[model samples]
Target: MSGLDQRRVLVTGASGTFGRQLCAAFTAAGARVVGVDRQPGSIDGVPVLGCDLTDPATVPPVVAAAVDRLGGLDLLVNNAGVGGPAPAELPPDEVVRQQLEVNLLAAWRTTAAALPALEAARGRVVFVASRMALLPLPLAAAYGVSKRALVAYADALRHEVGTHVGVSVVYPSMVASPIHDSTADAGLSLEGVSRPEPVQGVVAAILRAATARRAPRDVATTRRGRLELAFARHAPTLADRLVRRTVATRIAAGDLDAAPLAAGMLRRHRDATG
Candidate 1:
C-alpha cells in the first residue's frame, strides 16, 4: 500500500539492525527486495548476497547480480555504515579510515554500480546518513565526517543523475544497535546527548522518501532530529555553542573520563575552565 507494490528494491548492509527492519518493511509493503552484505544469507525470507562493499572490486558484480535477480532495480538503499570514537585532535587513524571507507566510499561504489539499472528503471537511491552528519558531536569525528561526506556525495550524484534517477538522504538521530558498540566500549556513549529512537522510525522515513511523489532531498527520522538539523543548517554558530556546552558539561561530570580517545579533549577543557 506504499506505492511499492511489485517494485524491485536492492539494499546494502542487509544484515545490519536497520537493514533487516528496512528490508522486512519493504517486503511487507509488497516490494521485491534483495540485499547485499559481507555475509550472505537470508533475512525475513529476503535473499541476501555477500559482498564486501569496501572492496571496489566486489561491488559492481554483486550489484549487477542482485539487479539481475530482482529483474530490474527500482530502489537502492545505502544502509551500510560503521561507527567508533575518534577525536578530532588526533591525526586520522584506522577508525577514521574505516568509517570513511564504509560510510562514504562504499555507498558511493554501490550507487555507482547500481546507477545503470536504476537509471534504466528510473529508480531511487536512499542513503541512510545520521544526525551527526549535520550536528557533529565531539569524540566521534569519524562518524560525523564520513556521514557528512556521504551527504555531499548524494548531493553531487543527484545533480548528475537527477534527470533519470531519484536521490534522497535519511538522517536517523540514534538507534540502539551494534553500530554504537565501539563507541560505548570506549566509554563515549551518547546517552545524555542523544535519545535513542526506535529503528522502525528510520525504516518508515526511508520508505516514505522512496514512495514520495518527488524524492525528498533529505529526511529526518524523528522530530528532534529535524530540529537539530534545522539549527545546524540555519544557525550554525549557535549549534556549535550548544554542542560545546554539552561537551563541557559531560566533561565536568566525568562522563568521558574513561574514554582514552577523549582524554586530550577533557584535559584541554578542564585546563581552560580552571
Candidate 2:
C-alpha cells in the first residue's frame, strides 16, 4: 500500500493554486484531507475551514476542527503566504510585516497548534517556502527573508521533533498560477523568473517530501531552482554577478526605481563579498 493511503492530512492555503493541487493529490491517494484558508473555498467536498493565519486565536480552533474531522492529523502543510515584490530599497513596511507574519509566524502558530495531533499520529509537517529563499530575487527582499526564516524554522523544528514527526520544506520556482498575479499587477518586474514549473510537478515533489521515511533537509522543484541553490552555496560571486546584472538591466529599462536605490543594493553585495 502507498504510504499516503488512509493518511489524515491538514493543508493550509487550500484555496491557493499549489494548495488546491496538494489537497486533490492527497485525497486521490486515499488520505482524509482537511484544508484551511482565509478565503471561503472547498475542494472535492474536502472540508476547508476559513481562518486568518495571522490571527493566533483563530488558529487553535481551526486546527481543532481539522483534527476532529480527520479523526486525527497525519500531515500538516503550511502553504499560506503573500508575496510583496517591489524595489528592495523601499519596501512598504506594512506589506513586509504582513509577509513575515503570514509566511513565517503563521507557519509557527499552525504547526504548534497541530504538533500534538501530528506527534500522536507520527505524521509529517511541510512548509511551502519559495525559490527566493535560496537565492534572493531582485526587488523581492521581503518575500525572500520571510521564506528564508520559514526554512530556518523548519530545520530547527525537524531536529527537535524528528523522532516523532517528519519535517520538510519545498522551494519551488515560478509556477503558472495566480499567486504571481498580484505581484505583477503591483508593477514588480519578473525578468529574473525562469520558465514556470508545471503545477503538477511541484505538487508531486511536495508529497514526496511530506511522506518520505526521512524527510530531506530541503526540496526544490525545478532545474533553475537547483542550479541557483548550488550557485548560492559554492559560487556566491557568480550568483551576485548574475543578480546584479539583472538589477542593472531592470534599472536601465526603468522597471525598477531610481539609480541610487539600485546602487545601494549593489554596494551591499560588493561589501559583503569584499
lDDT values, one for every candidate: 0.93, 0.82
* lDDT (tens digit, per residue) of candidate 1 on 1-274: 1399999999899999999998899999999999999998999899999999999998899999999999999999999999999889889999999999999999999999999999999989999999999999998999999999999999999999999999999999889999999999999999998889999999999999999998999999888888999999999999999999887888889898888988788778888989
Highest TM-score: give the candidate number.
1
Candidate 2: lDDT over CA atoms?
A: 0.82
lDDT of 2 by residue, 1-274 (tens): 1388888998999998888888999989888898999966678888889999999999999899889988998889998888855556784678789889999999999999999999998888989998778778766788899999999999899889989988888988777677677567656646454456788888988888877777777787876777878888799889888877776666556664443435566566557657
- Ten-residue segment with the worst summed lDDT in candidate 2? 254-263
Output the TM-score of candidate 2: 0.89
Per-candidate clashes come to 0, 0
Q: List the residue pairs that clash in candidate 2.
A: none
Candidate 2 clashes: the total is: 0
User: Evaluated with lDDT, which candidate comes out highest?
Assistant: 1
